[model samples]
Target chain A: MRRIHILCVEDEPEVLEAVVRDLAPFEEVFPIEATATADEARRVVRDVILPRGELGLAICDHILPGEDGVSFMVHLHAQEATRATRKVLLTAQAGLQATIVAVNQAALSHYLAKPWNPDELVAVTRRLLTDYVLETQTNLYPFLSLLEADRLTERIRSGPLPGDE
Target chain B: MSIPIRPLDRIREALQSIPEAQSEVRDFVTGDVLLREGDNPGTISLIIRGEIELLKHAEDGDEYPLGTLRPGQLLGLLSLSSGNASFFTARAASEGTLLTMPDDRFVELLHNRIDFHQVVTPLLLGNLVDRYRRVVRLHLEVAELTRDLNAEKRQLQAAIDELEETRNRLVQQEKMATLGQLTAGIAHEINNPIASLSRAADLLHPQWHKVFGEGIERGLTPMFRQAFELGVTREPLQTEIQRQRTAELARLFPDLPRPLVRTLAQVNPESFAELRSAMQRVPESVRLSLLSQWAATFEAGVLVRNVRVAAERIGGIVGSLKSYSRQDKADEDAVDLRQGINDTLVLFGYVLKKFILVVDLPELPPVRCRPGEINQVWTNLILNACEAMGDTGTLWVCCGVRPPDQVWVRIQDSGPGVPRELREKIFESHFTTKQIACARGSGLGLGLAIARGIVEKHGGRITVSDAPEGGAIFTIFLPTGAAPD
Candidate 1:
C-alpha cells in the first residue's frame, strides 16, 4: 500500500524546521524550499519538486514576501502533478474575506491560523490524510452499491456538512 | 498697554570711561522703528530711556511681535547667525534715548572690550541655544505629524473599503432574502396542489387493482360452482355423470391428490384461506414501497426547512454587518461598554466559531461614547487576542466600570503572551509577532492600530498586558463624557 506524500512549503526558516520536525515522525514528509520571495518558491517547485512525482498534500504559508501564499496554491492547482495535493493555508491575519477567498477558490483541506501549535497542526494534517485515504478507496469501485462510500465526494465538496453537529 | 520707559543713565555712566567704548546717541518717539532686522546687520542698540517693541514679519504676511525690551538688554544679535535672517523687526514703543554703534566698531569693541563682551556673549549664546532647541523640536513634531497623517489616510481608506464591502453584502443579502421569500411562497403555493395529487393517486391506486382482481375471480367462481352442481343432481344423470366423471377422473386422476397439489397450493394456493393470504400481500407490499417513498419525501421536507433556515441566516448576517458598518461613523451616541463588548462578540461570530471566547463582563450602566467606534475597540483587541492564540485557544473578555465613570474592557487569550520589550509598540500599526508573513502576519495587525485610534478619539485609552493564563491581555478604558441633562 502506498502512503500519501506531503509537500510542506514555508518561508520562515524556524517555522519550516518546526513543520518538518513535526511531520517527519508520522509520515513521509517532503520539505520544499524556504525562500524569502514567492518567485524563489515557484522556481523551486517547478525546477525541483515536480520531477519527483504527484504530491498528496501542499502546506502553504499565506503571507510570503514577493507573492501571497493563496496565489501560489492556485498556481500549484494549475500544475498537473500537484493539482490533487490537499492544500492548507497558514495565516496570522484577523480579517474574514481573505480566509473566505482561500477556502472558496483554493478548495483548501484546512486553514491553520497562526500562531498554531505543533501538536495541533500534526493532528489536523493526520486527520486530513486519513480522510483522503477513505476517499481514494471509495472512488476505486464506482459500481459498488454502498451510497455511504460514494457520497464522500459530495460531502467534501460541500465543505462542512450540517450533520457535523 | 503703555508703560513708561526708564532711563539707562546709570549703565552709560558706568561704561563711559572705558577706552574701547564707541557710542552715539539718538532720540526716538513713540512707535518709532528702532531696528529694521536685516537693515543694520552688526549694529547693537542700547535702550537708554523708554520702551521698545520688536516685530518680525515673514514673507507670507504672518507677523510675530516679540516681547518688550528693557533698559539693560542689548539688541541686534537676532541677525548674528551668518545664514539666518533677523529673528524679528524691532520698534520703539515710546519716546526714548538710544546709544548706537557702527558695525565695524562693534566688532572692534567685541575684540578689545573684555568687560563688554564678557557680559554680552553669554546672553547671546543662551538665546541661540534656546532658539536651536525650538527648531529641532519643531522638526520632530513635523515628522510625527506626517506619520500620523499617513496612518489616518490608510485608516480612512480601510473604512471606505469596509463600507463598500458592507454595501455589497447588504445588496446581496437583500436579493437573497427576496429570493428566499419567493422560494418559500412558491413552495407554499405548490404544496397544496402536489398534496392533492398525491392523495388522489393514493385513493385510486389500490381500488383499481382490487376491481380488476375481483372481476376475474367472479367469472371463474361461477363456472366451477356450475360444474359441481351438475355432477351432484339426479340418478340417471348421476350414472351418466359418473361415467363422464370417471372419464374426467381418468384425465385428472391420482396426481391431483398427490403431494404436489398440497405443495402447489401452499406456494400458489387456490383455497379461500390462500386467496385471503394472497390478497393481504398486496397492501403489505404497497405499504413497504410507499414507506421508502415517504422517507424520500421526508428528506425533501428537511431540505426545504434547511433552505429557509439558510436564507434567514444570510439575512441575519447581513443585518449585523450593516449595523457594524453604519455605526462606525454615526454620531457619538451614549454607549454601554458592556453591551458594546457583547455586540462585538456577536459581530465576530465567525472568528469565535474557531476559537473559544470566555466573557467575564461586568454589569454596569452606560458609558457615554460613540458605540460604533468603541465597538471597533473590542473588535481589534479581541481579534488580536485570538490571533495571538492561533484561534483555537481560550479567550477571556472582561469589562468593568472604574471610579470617576471610566469603563474598562479587557480581553485575554491562552496563546503566548507579548514579549516585555514589544508590548508598548504592539499597538503601533503594522506590527506583528507571527513568523510567516511578518509584513502581513500574513493579515492580523490592522485591528490593533484601528482600535487604539478609536479609543483615543473617544478620549479613552487602550493597552496590552499579560494574561493570567500566560497569553496576552488587551485592556481599554472609555471616559463617559457626561450624564444627560
Candidate 2:
C-alpha cells in the first residue's frame, strides 16, 4: 500500500515551520512534508516522494523566490504522476489574475489566506486528503480515524476492498 | 459733380484732339516702372488701356501698394500739381497703354484754350476730390486692421496664460502623486515586519514558560539537558529527509506524541539517536515531559529568528527608501546609475511579482547628477513598463556606459508594443494610452513627460523605439560629466 503525503511549499522559514507544526497530528497516518522553495519541492516530488508515496495534497504560497507557486501547481497538474494532487493556494499577495489561473488551470481546491486559523487548515487538509484517498487508494483503513469516519465506513461496507476475492 | 462726361474722361478727349498728343502715347507690359518715388519725371501719364499700381515706398525701401489706377485715371499727378518730385512709384500691373503729356504741354493746354480751361478746372478739382476720398478710405482700413490685430493679440495672450496655469497645476499634481507613492511604499514595507514582530512576541511568552515550567517540575535528567541543548543547535530539515526521519522516529517511539516525533525529526540524526537511547532509561512520563521541553525551546528559537529577520527586512526597506529619495544626501552627487535602478526596483518590488524582470547592468562610472531626480526617471520608466505588460510578461532593464561621456539605460517589456505612430506622441504632456480610470487616478500621462523634462534638464536625450524582443523600449541617455542646474 502506498503512503499518502501532504506537502507544503512556503518561502518563509517561520511560516513553513508553523504550517508543519499545525499539521503534525496527521504525521502518523499521512506523512507531511515541507519545503522552502518551489524547486526543492519539485525535486522532492520527483526523486523521493513519488517512489513510495502518492501526493494527496499540496498547500502552496503563491509568491516564491524563483518560480512562483501558481506556475509550479500548473506544472504539477499537467503531469500524470501528480495530476490528482489536491491543490490549495495559501498566500497573502496573489492578485486577481493569478488566483484566477490557479483556479482555472491549476485546479485549485481551496484558498487559505495568510495568518490562517490552525483548526481550519487542519480540517481542510483532512477533508482533501480523505477525498483523494477515497477516490484512489484501495486500502482505506489507515485514514479511517483521521478522515470522515462515517463516510469511510459507508464506502467500506458498500464494496469489497480491491484485491479481495 | 453732375457733368455729362466724367472730368478725367473729358480731359483725355481734349488731349487726344491735339495733334501732338498722339506721339505721346506709349504701350507698356506688366511690371514696367513708369515713375519712381522722389523722381521728377516732368510728365503726367494717363492710363488709356489697362491698370497701373501706385506704390508708396517706406524709409526702409519696402514698397506698399497705395492704390491702383485704371483707364482714364492719371499718374504723376501729385508731383505735377505740387511742382515737386513724385511721392508714389507707378508700375504697369498688367499690359497697358499710357499717354504721357509733358508738364510744359500740360500747362500750355490749360493757358491757350478757353475750352480746355473748362475741362481742366473740373478735371483737376475732380482728381483732388478723388485723392482725398482714397486717403480717407485708407485711414479707415488701417484703423479697422489695427483693431482686429489687437483683438487677436489679446486672444493669443489669454491662451498662453491659461496654458501656463494648466502646466503649474499639473506640476503640483505630479509632485503629490510621487509623494503618495512613496508614502504607500513605506507603509507597506513597514507593515509586514511589524506584524511579524508582534506575532512572534505574542507567541514567545506562553511557549517559553511551557518548556521550562513542565521540565523543572518533572525533573530534568543530565541526558535530557544534553538533548535539549543539542536540539537547539539542530539544523533545519530538508523536505524529503525530514519526511523519512519523522517516520523513523515514529516507528521507534510508537507511544510518543506526534508533535514530539515531528520535533525530534528536526534534530541532528546522531544526537536524536542518542537522545532516544537515553529516553529508554527514563520513565515514559518523564521522557515525554523532556521531549516537550525540547520542542518548546526549538520553537522559541524559531520565533526569535523570525523577529530578528523581520526587523532586518524593515531596516533594509527604510535604507532603500532613504537612498531612493536622497533624504540624507546632497542634491547633487556622484551616483552610480545601476544603484539608482536597483533602488527604484526595490520601491516597485511589490508590483513586480507578476513580472519576470531581467536586469543586465554592467559596471558603470559615476555620473554627477541630482540623485533623486535621476531616480524619478527610472521610476517612471519602470512603472510604465509594468503597467504596459500588465501581468505575466518579461521586463528587461539594461544599463551601460556609452563612449564620449554618456551613460544609457534602456527599459523594455514584453507586451503590446507602442504603435509606431504614437511613439512620438506618448511623450507629450497629458497624453496617455491607458483607459480613463487608470490614467486619471494615477497621474499616468505626466510620467513620461516629467521623465523627458528631467533628462533634458540634465543635458540628455530620451527616445522610444520597438524593442528587439517585441515591446516598447524607452532609452535614456545622460551625460557622465556634471549635469547642468
Candidate 3:
C-alpha cells in the first residue's frame, strides 16, 4: 500500500497538538506528521516523509516565529518533489496580502481560519487528500475509508480494475 | 514757546556793568565744580557763558543731576537768598565763563541798582517756572516707561504659558499614538492565544467523552491508563526521531500492524519501550484496541495542556497591559523602569518575532514617573528601531544605572543608521527623512518626537547615536530623584 501523510506546521506546540488530534480520524491511514517550525517542516520533508511516501497535504499557520507559512508554502510549491502538495493556510491574523501571496504563488488550495470547525477541516482534508490520491497514487482502496469515498469510487470505476495476475 | 535770550550773552552784558572793584570773570572747563554743595563761597557766582548743571550728592556721595542751569541761571540763588551754603553742587556742564562778586557787593547792587534788580528778578522767576515744568514732563515719561515694561512682562508670561501647554499636548498626542499602537499590537499578540483557547475549549468535551464515556473495557485497559499518564507528561516527538523509532519498531514487530507500530513509536523513549513490552503480553487482535484507547487519553492530556498554556499567555498579556497602560493614573507612579520595559516588550511580542532580540534588563532602582508615559517612550524607540531595520534584524536592549542618581535604557538596531547631519533634526516635531520623497502619512517617525517629549517631561532626556555597525542607538536617561513638574 502506498502511504500518504498529512503534515502540520505550527510554532505553537499546543495548537499543533489540537490540530493533529482534530484530524486524528484519518490518522490510521494517513499517519499525520507534526513540526513546530517551517525550518523543521522542511527538514522533515527532505529527510523523512518524502523518501518514504508522498505528502498529500500541508496545513500551515501563516504567522510563525521565523519564515511565515505563506513563504514556506511558496517554497514548497517551487520544489519539484512536493510541487503538487495541496497547501492550506490556517491562521487568525493573516492579512489579505498574505492570502494573495499564498494564492498566487503557492496555489493555496484552502484558507482555514483559526479555531477551525473540526468537521470542515476533516472534509477539506478528505477532499484534498482524495485529489492527491487520484493525481499521485494509482492505488485507492487503502485510503477508501478515510478519504472521499464517492470520488475514489468514481475514480476506481472509470479506470480498469486491477487484475489478479 | 518763547526761546529764552541766549543767556550766556545777557549774563556777560550784565557782568560788564558790575563795578570792576567788586566783580571778576573766570573760565572753567567741563567737570569743574563751580561750587561744592556744602561750601560757603563768600562770592556769589553767576554764569557768564556756557551752562552749569546743578547736582545733588546722594548720601553715598554719588552726584545725581537735579537740573541744568544755562548761563543766565544763578548758581547760588537758593543759598544766597536763604543765607545758607550752596544748596546743590554746581558743576560746569561745558566750557564756560562765570562772573563773581562779594555777597556784600551783590546785596549793595540789589539795593542800589534798580536796573540790575529788574534784569535779575524775572530771569530768576522764569528759571523757577522752567524747572517746575520739567518735573511734570519727567513724571509723565516715567509713567509711560513703566506701562511699556509691564506690557513686556505680561507678553513674556503668555509666551511661557503657551510653550508649557504645547509641551503637554505633545505628550498627550504621543500617548494617544502609543495607545493606538499598543492596542493594535496587543490585538495581534492576543490572537494566537485566543485561537488556542477556543480550540482547546472546543476539544475539551469531545476528549472527555472519549476517555470516560465510551465503551467501558477500552477505557479501563491498563495500556490506556499508562498512555494517559505518559501523554499528560510527554511532549510530542520530533518527526525525525519518530521516524527512527518507527523503523526500529517495524523491524522488531514485523507481524504487527504498521500504523499501530508508528503510533507506539511516537511516545517518549521509555514509554515507547515500556508500551512495546506491555503490548507483547497482549494478543495482536487486542493491541490495536488498546492503542486506540491510549491515543484518546493522550489527546485529552494535550488539549488540557493547550488550555493551560493559552490561559497563562492571556493572563500574562493582561498583566503587562495593565502595567503598560496605567490608565486613570493621575500622579507620578514609582516604578522600576525595567518592569515597564518588560511589559512593553511583552506588548511587542508579535512584532519582535522578526528580530533577534537581546534584552539585558537587570533589576533597576525605582524612579518616580508616570509609568504609562515612560512605557510610551520604550514602545516608540523599540518600534522606531524595528521600523528602521525593516523586515528583519538584530536588536540589542540593555539597562544601566549610574548609581544613586540616574538610570538609562539603550535600544540599538541593525539598520541603516541616521545620517550624522540629520541626527540633530530627527527629534524635532514632524521631522522625517522621507518627507520629500514619501507622502506625509507614510513618513517614518512621529513617535520619536513624542518619545522625546515624554522623556523631557520627566526631566529626563533621550538621544540617538550611531551604533557600532550601521544602525541607530537610542538611549533614554532618567533621573532617579524627583523630576521637576
Candidate 4:
C-alpha cells in the first residue's frame, strides 16, 4: 500500500530540523522527508518518496542554493504526478512579486514566514495534509488522530470513503 | 502721389525711344499673380512699387516663400537672360506697379545702345547683387539653425543619460537601505531566541553530567562523552555516502538494532575502534535494551550543538549586515576597508557561496570614508567579477596603504576578462557587454559606471587591467587624508 508523505525542502538544516520536529505529530501516518536543495529535493521525490508513496504536502523555503523554491514548485505544478500536491512557501525573503508567482503559477497553499510559531506551523500542516487526504485518499481512519479530526470524522459519518470508479 | 510708382526714370528715358518697349507702367492690386513658374513672361517687368513675393511651388502643392522683392528689382530679366520662362511664381505682396516690354527688344536695347546699356546695366547689377546677398544670408541662417539644433540635441541626450545614471544610483541606494534594514530587523527578531538557545545548551551540558550514574553507566562515561562530542561536531553526510556507511556499520554489528547501527554510521570515526571494543562488553541480548537510551543522549548532543552553531552563525550574519548597512553614518567617519569588505562578503553570501574568495586585506590605516558607499563600490566590482565568472570562480580582493597618503584596493577574478581593446570603453556610462538580467534592470549594466562615479566622488581613481590569472583586475586608489566634499 502506498503511503502519504510530507516533504520539507529547506537549505538550512537547523530550520529543516525545526520544521520536521513540528510535523512529528503526523509522522506515524504521513512519513516526513527532508532535503536541502531543489536538486536533492527532486531526487528524493523521484527516488525515495514517489517510489514508496504519494507526496501529500511540500513546504519549501523560497530561496535555495539553486533553482528557487517558487520555480521548483512551478515545475512540480507542471508535472502530472505532483500537480495536486499541496504547497506552502516558507520564507523570510520572498518579495511580493515572488509570492504572486507562487500563488498564480504554483498554486501555493499557504505562506509561513521565518521564526514561525510551531503550533501554527503544525496546524497549517494538518489542514493542508487533511485537505490532501480528503481529496485523494479513501482511508480516513489512519489520519483520525493527527489530522483535523472533526472534519475527517464528519466526512466519515456523512458517507463512506469513495472507492475507485 | 500716383498709385502706381512709375518705373525707374532711367528705365523710362531709355525705353522712350525703344520701339518694342512700353514706357507707360501698369498699376496692379495685391491679389495679382505676376507670372506663374514655368510660364513665358513675354516682357521684362520691373517691380515699380510696394512688394512682390517670390514663391517656389512644391510637388506637395504647398508654396515655399523664398523671399520678397522690392521696388527697383527686375523681375523677368534674369529669367529672360537664362531662358524665356519664369523660374518662380511672383505674386503681388502689396498693391504695386509693373512695366512690360518685348523680351527680345529689351535684350537688343541693353546690348546695342551704349546709353541704354549703361542705364539699365546698373539697375540689373544692383538687383543682382541684392538677390545674391539675400541668398547668401539665407544659407548662413539655415546653417546657424542646424548647428543650434544639433547642439541642443546633444545637450538633451546628455541630460537623458545623466538622468538614467541618477536613477540607477537612487535605486542602488534604496537597495542598500532595504538590505540594511532587513538585516537589522532579522537581528532584532532573532537575537533573543538565539541568545536563549545558546544559553540553554550551556545550562544543559553541565546538568546532564550530574545525573551521571542514575541512567548512564559510569564505566561507559568515556564512550558516552565520545558519542556526545561526535554528535556535536559531525556534519551530515551525503545520502549516498550515508547509505554506504550505514551498510558497512550494519555488517560490522549485524546483531545490533538497525536504528542503533544507523546512528553509529553518522558519528563517522574519530573513535570507532574504541566504540567497537566497548560494544564487545554488552551481551547481544542487552544491546537492544541500551539502544534507546544511547540514541537519546546522542540526539540531545546533536540538537543542542546545532542550536549553538546556528546561533553563532546568525550572530555573525547580523553583525556583518549591521556593519554593511549603517547608512546613517556620517561621511567623515574613518573605517577599516577590510571590515567593510568582509561585511559585503557576508551580505553576498548567497551569490558567492560557490565562489572561492581569496582576501588578503592586511592591517592598514583607517581611511576617512562613507562606509556604505565604499562597500557599494566593493559590491559593484565583486558583482562584476561574479558575472564575468558566470557565478563560479575564484575572486581575489586585497587592499594596501602606500607609505604616502594613498590607499588602494584591487579586485581580481578568474574568468574570461575584458579584452585589452575594451578596457577603456568599459568605464564609459551605459557601455555594457551583458544582456539585461531583469526587468528592473538593476545591477547588471549600470554597476561599473556607478562604481566609478562613487569612487571619483571620494577623490579616488579606479582602473582595470589584465590579471595574471587570466581574468580582469580592477584597482581603486583613494586619498587617505579626508573624504572629498
Predicted structure with the largest lDDT when compared to the true one: 4
- CAPRI band for model 1: incorrect
Residue pairs with backbone overlap in model 2: none
Clashing pairs in 3: none
How close is every model to the real structure, measured as TM-score? 0.36, 0.56, 0.63, 0.67
Give residue A26's error in model 2 in angstroms: 2.2
Per-residue lDDT tens digits for candidate 4, residues B62-155, read: 9999888888887787678788678799899899787667787788777788876766777777787888999899999999999999999999
Candidate 3 lDDT score at position B106:
79
User: Which ten residues in a row are the worst by lDDT in model 4 chain B?
Assistant: B436-445
**Model 3: iRMSD?**
4.2
Q: Give the winner by DockQ: 1 or 2.
A: 2
Off by over 4 Å in 3: A137-142, A156-165, B1-226, B235-266, B282-285, B433-444, B482-485
Residue-wise lDDT of candidate 3 within A1-165, one digit each (tens)? Answer: 447888999877678767876787787788777887788889888877888887889999987777878999999999998889999998887877778889999999999998899889988998899888899887888878878889999989988878944
> Proportion of native contacts found in each model?
0.00, 0.24, 0.24, 0.03
Docking class of 2: incorrect
Residues A1-165, candidate 1, lDDT per residue (tens digit)?
A: 333456565655445545654665443232222343356656656654555544556777765544567877777777766666778887665346556666777677888887789878877766665555455543323312222344455555655554665
**Candidate 2 lDDT, A1-165, residue by residue in tens:** 578888899977668888988898887777777888788899888876799888999999988866789989999999998899999999988877788889999999999998899999999998888889888977777888889888788888888766779
